[model samples]
Target: MQVSRTATKEDFNHLRIDDIKQPISESRFDALLEKLQINNLSEDEKDFFQSIVEDRMVTEEEFSTLTYEQTKKIKQFTSRSDLEGNYIADSSIGFEKLSMAPLLSAQNISDDEEYNEAIFNTFKKLNLSQDDGISMLNELGGYINQEEKIIFEDSLTDEQYDSGIRYKTYIGLDMKELVSKRLEELNQGLLETSDEDVKSDYKNMIYVYREIETQYNNIQDKNRVENEAQLEQYTRNTKPNPLYNADVVELYNNITHEYEEKEKKEFDELMDKLDISNLNNREKELFRTILEDKEISNIEMDKLSYEEMKKINQFIFKKDEKGEIIDDTLIRTNSRINALLRTTELTDDETFNQVLFNTVKSMNDIYEINNFLNPILNLISEKFTAFDEVNSINFITEDMNKVLDELIKTFDEHYQETEYDEIKEHYLSVINKYQDLKEQYNKTTIDS
Candidate 1:
C-alpha cells in the first residue's frame, strides 16, 4: 500500500483546482487544517475559503493576501458550475445571466416611477402646458429625443433609461425656471407693499432665490464641461436660457455687503492694535492669517515643526465667555512645559535642559509662560503651583484650555512608563526656579 504525505507550505503556494474542488479523506483533511492553522489564517485566506463556498469571486479587501495568478484562478473557478458534476456552457456560467432579476433591478424600477411622477407634478404646479412635460418625461425615459439634444449616447441604449443623467438635467432646468419666476413675483410684492416687515421678508426671499440661481448656473457649467468631454464636441455653442433677474440679484448683494462691511471694519481695528514688530516677514504673514481666521486647527497645526508652533504659541490669544478677546492675551512660551506634555516624544535630557535654562534666564515677569504652564500645572494640583490664586498664578484662559485639551488627549494615547522619581525631581526644580524668578522680578519692579 502507498502512503500519502501531509500537505506542506509548498503545496499551499500552488494549490491545484482538484485540491479546492474535491473533499480530502478524513485523515488528510485533518493534516491540511493543522498545517494551515485555521485560527491563524490571514484575512485573505479566510476570504478565499468563503468565496469558494458562496460561489463568488473574492473582493478587493482580500487582494493584499492573494497573488494575481491565485485571484484569477479563484474567480474563474467560483464563476463556473460543476467540475465534479456536468460542465455548463461559458455563455450561461454565472448566476447574473437572469434578465433584470438582480437586487439593483428592483431599485431601478422604483426610482423611475418616483421621478416620472415628480416631473408631471412640477408641470402642474407651475401651470405650464402638459405638451412640453410629456416630451421631457419621454426624453428622460430614453423613449425619444426628437430635437437631437446633447445627451450621453450610451445612456440612451435600449436598456438604459438615461435615468440619473437626463433626470438631473430636467430637474436643474425646472428648478432654475421656478426660482426665476418666484424672484419676479417677490420683486412685484416688494414694490406694492408698504408694510416694513413684509418688505423685509420679500428681500430675504429674494436673497435666497438669488443664491439658488448662482448654484444652478454652477451646476449647469459643470455639466456642460462633462458633456463636452464625453461627446468630443463643442457643447458650449448651445444657447443658455436667461438667468435670474439681475435687478433682484443686485438688490440682494447690496444687502449682503452691509454685514460684510461691518466685519471688515472690526478686523481692521484688531489688526491695527496687534504688535507684530518682533515677528519675521514669514512669521508676520502666519500671525496675520491666524488672527484673521481666529482658528488654529490642531490637525493642521500639528503638521508644523516644533519651532513654528513655539512661535504660534507666543501669539495665541485668550477669549472670554462671549468669544470676545480679553486684554493681555499674548502667550509666553516655555520649553519645559512643552517637554513635559510631549515627554514620550522629546526624550533627550540635554535638549530639555537647554530649553529650560533659556526660559529661566530670559524671563521678564512673574506671569511669563503662564498661558502654557498654568493649564498643565492645574491638571496636577499637589505637584505644582497654586493655579486658582490671581496673585502669582494666571489660570487657564479659554483659548488655552481648548489647545491644552487636544494636546493632553493626544499625549494620553501615546503615554509610556518611565522613571517617575527622575521626572518628579526635574519638575520640582523648574517650579522652585519659576517662583524665585517671580519674587525677584516683583521686588525689582517695586524698587524702580
Candidate 2:
C-alpha cells in the first residue's frame, strides 16, 4: 500500500501497501484489515474497537487506533463507491474531520495519563523539551489551572458536528485576531517577549492553529445552507423573476461550491507537500489564510464579495491567532507595530495593506461560477514565454481587453434607460480599474 499522507514513521517501517489497489470493497478491505493482524492490537486498541462496535464511548486512545484503519480506507478518495462503502452500516466510522483527530492524537500524543498529564504533553508539541514545558507551566501554570487548560484546549478545537458555526462565525475569527495581536505585541516586545514562557505560548498558538485547520476543513461543510440562501436572494434580485428564483438560486449555489472546490483542491495538494516546520509566522499566516479560505461558511462567503481581495488581506493581517477581524481603526498605532518586524513580507505599511487587498481581490473572480470575466476574457498560453507562439500572459491580457469591451457594452446597453448613478457608477468603476490594472501589468511584461 502506498503510504497514506497521514501515515506515521512507525507504520512506514512495518507496513507496505504496494498491492492494495484502489476501489477495494468491504470483503477485500476486511481481508486486508485482518491481514494486518488486529489480534496484535494493543490492549487499548482492542477495547477501543469493541467499544466502537458496542456504540459505547471509548477513550481517546481507542479513537486513535480506529483512525489508523479509517485512513487506510480513506486513501480511496478516487473511488467513490469504495469510499461510500466504508460508511454503509456504521456511518460515524468514516474519515473526515470526524475521524482523523483521534487517530492523530493516538499516534502522536500518547494517552497514558488522563487530564494533567495529557495537557502537559502539549509541552512536547510546542517543541519545548518536556522539562521546559513542564517547568514554565509549573511556574505560572497556577494562573491557568489544570481544568482551565483542558477547557482552553477543548474550546480551541475546530471540530466538526460539535464545532458550532458560531465558533467560526465569531469565536475562531476573534481568536485569530487575538493571537495576531499577541504576536504583534510580542514582535514589539522583542526584548520583553523572550521569556521562555512567552516563547512557549507562541509555539502553543501554532499548534492550536494547525489542529483547527486539520479538523475543521475551514468550516466548509458547515455553511452550505446559508450561502446558498443568500445566493438565492441575490439571484432573485437580479432576475426580478420570483417564479424561477428558487431554481436560479439552487443552480447558483452548486456553481459556487464547485468553484470553491477547485481552488481548494489545488491549495490542499500544494500544502500536503510542504515541510511546515521551515516556514515562518508570515508564511504560515498566508498559507493558513489560503487553506482556511475554502473552509468558510456560505454567509461569510456571501458577505466577502463586497470587500474584494482586500477583504482577505485585511482579514488575515488584522486577524489574531483565532481568526477575527482586527479594527481598521487600529491602523494609526499599528503602523509602528509593522515597523518592528524584520522580515521581507511587510516591506512597508502600504505593502502590508496591499497583501490584505490582494487576498480578497482574486477571490471572487476565480471562484464565482458565472464570473463572466474569467470564462470569456480568460487566456491560456504556453509557459515557455520566451519561445511561445505568443506570450501567454500577454495573450491573456489581450483577451482581457476583449472582455473589457464586452463589459462596457453590456453596461451601456442594459443601463441606458436607468439613471441609477450608484449602480451604473459602481460597475463602470470596476470595469475601468480592472482594465487599467491588467493593461499596466501587461505593459510591465512588455517592458521586461
Candidate 3:
C-alpha cells in the first residue's frame, strides 16, 4: 500500500523482463497470503494478491499497478522462494534461458518483423544466445535502425568503445572482417596504380589495416584459448620485441640512413691531408675500407703506427667540449698527450708491459710517447713506492721493471735521433721525471 515518491519508471525498468514474472513456493505462498489478508487493502487489491499466491505466479499485468515499495517486496519474496512447477519455463521455449535475462522482450524493442527476423537469425547462426543480442540492443544507441544494422552511440568513450568491441568479438561477431576487406582492396589498388605517391598512400593504408586486423586476431585468439598454458604460449609468441622486429628495425635504419655527399667529400679531403698516397698498400686498403657503416677490426688496426692511429682517432671519435661525439671533422697534424692514470695490478704486469712496449715503440713523436708513459710512471711513483721493500722489489721485478726498462730505452733512442727541439725537450723532461721517480723508489726502499 506504501509507494516511494522518488521511484521513477527508469528505475523500475532497470529490472530484467523475466524477473517481473517470478514464481513462489507453497510455504512462501501461505506466508505471503496470510500477510496480505491482514493488510488494509481494497477488495480488488486483496483478490489480486490472493490470486498471485493461489496460482503461484506473478505476472506483468499484476506487477504494473503496484507501488514501487509493493513491487520491491514482491521481487524480494519471489527471489527467495523455492520455485516449483513449469510456470513460464524455458522448456516451453526452444532454447535454454540465460542467467542475465533480457531487460526488454525482443518483440517490445523491435517493431519491424523483417528486421527482427534478419537480426535474430544472424545471432542464431553466430551461436550467440538470445540474451547476448538483447543485452547488446539495450546498450545500443537505437534498437530500431532504418538501415537494419547495429550502431554504437557517438558519445561512447574510448573505454566503452573498446568494451563494446571486446563483447562483440567474444560473441562471434566479425570484428576484423571490414579491416581485412580494406586491406584486400588496397592490395588491388597498389597493383593498379603506377604513380609512386599513390602507391605509397595505398601501402600506408594497407599497413594500417593489416595492423588493425592483427589486433582483432589477437583478441580472438586470446578469447578462444582453452587454458592458461595455451594463452601464455600465444602471448609469448605474438608479443613484438621492438628492437628485433624487422619492420621496426628497418624503420629506424631508414631514419638514420641520411648519409650526404658532403660528408663523403670531407672524408676524402681528410684522407688526402693525411697523405693517403704515402701509405703502404696494406695500410691504404685498410684505410679505404673504413666507412660510415664499416669499421676496421682490432687485428687489422694493430698494423697502423701510433701517429696514424692518433690521426684516425681524431677523425673517428672527435668529441665536442661537452665530450659528446659530433659529426664535425677533426684534423690533427700531431698526436696530443692522453694519459690514463688508473690503478694497475702487478699481476697484470706482462700484458701491460707488452701493450705499453708496442704502443711506445710505434710512436714517432716525443709528445705521444711522453703522454702515454706519464700515467704509468705516476702510478709507480705514488703507489709502488708506498709498498714495503720486499713487496716493492717483488712488484717491480714482476710488473714495473719490464715496461719501465723498455720505456727508458725507447726514450733514449728517440732523444738521440730526433732533430726537433720541441721533441727533444719533452723527451728529456719525461726521462728526468722517470729518473726522479726511480730515485724516490730507491730512497723509500733503502730506508725500509
What order do you get sorting by lDDT, best first? Answer: 3, 1, 2
Instruction: Return the TM-score for each candidate structure.
Output: 0.22, 0.28, 0.20
Which numbered prediction scores highest in lDDT against the true structure?
3
User: Model-by-model lDDT, in order?
Assistant: 0.37, 0.33, 0.41
Local error of candidate 1 at residue 332 (angstroms): 20
Highest TM-score scorer: 2
lDDT of 1 by residue, 1-448 (tens): 1011122233334444443444333344334334433244456654545443343222334433433234323332222222122222211113332211111111111122222233333322333233332322322232222111212222233333212222122221344455467688878878876544346546755664464355445544665677876553334322222221243234324443553465456544544454333556677555554443333432223334455554454445545456655543443223433332232222223233234334432443435555335544455333333432222233222332233344454344333333576755544454455454344534544565
Better of 2 and 3 by TM-score: 2
For candidate 3, give the lDDT: 0.41
Per-residue lDDT of model 3, residues 343-387, tens digit only: 122224434533444445445455656675665655565555444
Number of the candidate with higher lDDT, 2 or 3:
3
Residue 54 local lDDT, model 3 = 43
In terms of lDDT, the poorest run of 10 residues in model 2 is: 164-173
Candidate 1's TM-score:
0.22
